[model samples]
Target: MPSLSQFSRCLFFILLSMIVTQCADKSVEENLADGIKFTEDRQYLRALDAFQQAVAKEPGNPKAHYSLGGIYNLMNRLPEAEQEFKIALKIDPTYVDAIYSLGFTYELMGDKEKAQPYYDKYNKLKQKWNEVLQKESETR
Candidate 1:
């Protein structure tokens, strides 16, 4: 019953919405789950593939970057590990695991000075978490 222009406009909006929804279905969480499973199985290459897929899906996912960094650290690829950890940290500065891993990566690379600050941050964050847990337990 609509005019030609109105029908065209409605069709365009519907198509646009579908495209946006499809693009937004990036599967970052699914890939992360697969990566964790592969990593737990000690299948490094498979884990890498999964994590890489996760990163591809969501470049801003700190967990994907952190998982990639952890894999690189295990493989003795210190520079790549450091870079991934830095990326994770850049995406989420409060990601404690990434902060700890960055310190550990620097230590592995023999950069004690670089490692020290991260270690301090890791310790501070751990302490904060512990205190939070303590307060929660006290209240309950």
Candidate 2:
């Protein structure tokens, strides 16, 4: 069995971890919001840093990755943008924006064949989603 002091230290470490995690979560939210604001303000580098922090904190968020990909694309960093888009698609395979943007990235790279398949997929998904939204709008 462990000593009382050892148990106390262990508990402290756990509590500290919990606090740190909470702080990380808040920072991620702040970073993500700032990223979008910076992007809209045309501060691409600042936006990239903020988005990078957000993705580091929340690796599973497809939207964060997608937005970062957009900033990279706007900066004409095609490879980085494609990587981010690929991550977004991995996180959420049905992410339409990621698929479309990946397709667009290929187009930017002058890879017409790769772009065509993704473009067709984006069109089909966009149409399907639009139909769903229209039906919902009609219902309401």
Candidate 3:
């Protein structure tokens, strides 16, 4: 049997881990929001830091990747923007914004041919989304 001290230590560590995880989740959201605000203010470096933090905390989050990509695009860092947008799309293929942004990035990089397909995909997805919204409105 574990000693009382050992049991207490184990329980304390478990509780600490739970608290850390909860805080990390909230931090990621806060970082993402802060990044957006910074971007709106045109503080690209600060926005980059905040978005990078969010991405680090939540590597699988498409929104974080998208936001980071947007900052890169604004800074004219086309390659980085392309990469982040691609990662976002890979995480969520139906992310319309990422799809559009990737195409825009490609266009900015002077690759209209590569951009065309993504633009097409974005348009099709938008049309489908609008149709769904229209049907929902009709039902209502």
Every candidate's lDDT: 0.91, 0.92, 0.95
Cα error of candidate 2 at position 68, Å: 1.4
Worst-scoring 10-residue span by lDDT in model 3: 20-29
Give the winner by lDDT: 1 or 2. Answer: 2
Candidates 1 and 3 compared by TM-score, better number: 3
Q: Across residues 19-82, which tens digit of lDDT does each residue of candidate 1 receive?
A: 9787467588877788788889998898898888888877988999999899888878899999
Give the number of the best model, judged by lDDT. 3
lDDT for each residue of candidate 3 in 86-134, tens digit (9 for 90 to 100): 9999999999999999999999999999999999999999999999999
Report the C-alpha lDDT of model 2 over 1-140, residue by residue, as the tens digit. 89999999999999999998875766767888898899899999999988998888889989889988999999999999999999999999889989999999999999989999998999999999999999999999
Worst 10 residues of 1 by lDDT: 22-31
**What TM-score do all the candidates reach, one by one?**
0.77, 0.76, 0.81
lDDT of 3: 0.95
lDDT of 2 at 51: 90
Question: What's the best-to-worst order under lDDT?
Answer: 3, 2, 1
Against the true structure, candidate 1 has what lDDT? 0.91
Candidates 2 and 3, the one with greater TM-score: 3
Off by over 4 Å in 3: 1-26
Pairwise lDDT winner, candidates 1 and 3: 3
